[model samples]
Target: MNAPQVSPIGGLPSRGFAEPHQNKQQAAPKNDALVQIRCSKAAAKEVKRAAVEAEMTISEFMLVCFHAYMKR
Candidate 1:
């Protein structure tokens, strides 16, 4: 006889879990705005590397930098 695989959080099988957020139309809040930035290839690569080092998404890192600039 084979035993069923269970989820780490509960006895329910992993496949039984429902991810409601996945079905949502929008991931971010309505008040949040989007901004686009264009940079040279070298600058883009440096930003990606810095974001990784800071353990943040590229967007998060950019927001942090922007806020710091605004405060100065």
Candidate 2:
């Protein structure tokens, strides 16, 4: 009787793809914190527009603005 062919490497089949964590979104940095701001709808819209124009997330734009204000 002919024996069935087997992989030389005996283990779980290798997935032809990246591991789950490799494809996952990066975890937030340890030093980062979430801050919520309360504002009127008009103010929110203005901030969103400014962030978009600056090509930054609102948090990044706000941090830049805060640093600038601190330097003044």
* Candidate with maximal lDDT: 1
lDDT of 1 by residue, 1-72 (tens): 999966667765566667578547577568666555567999879877888888997678878878855676
CA RMSD of all predictions: 10.5, 10.3
Q: Per model, how many backbone clashes are there?
A: 0, 0
Give the least accurate 10-residue stretch of model 2, judged by summed lDDT. 22-31
Off by over 4 Å in 1: 1-34, 68-72
lDDT of 2: 0.73
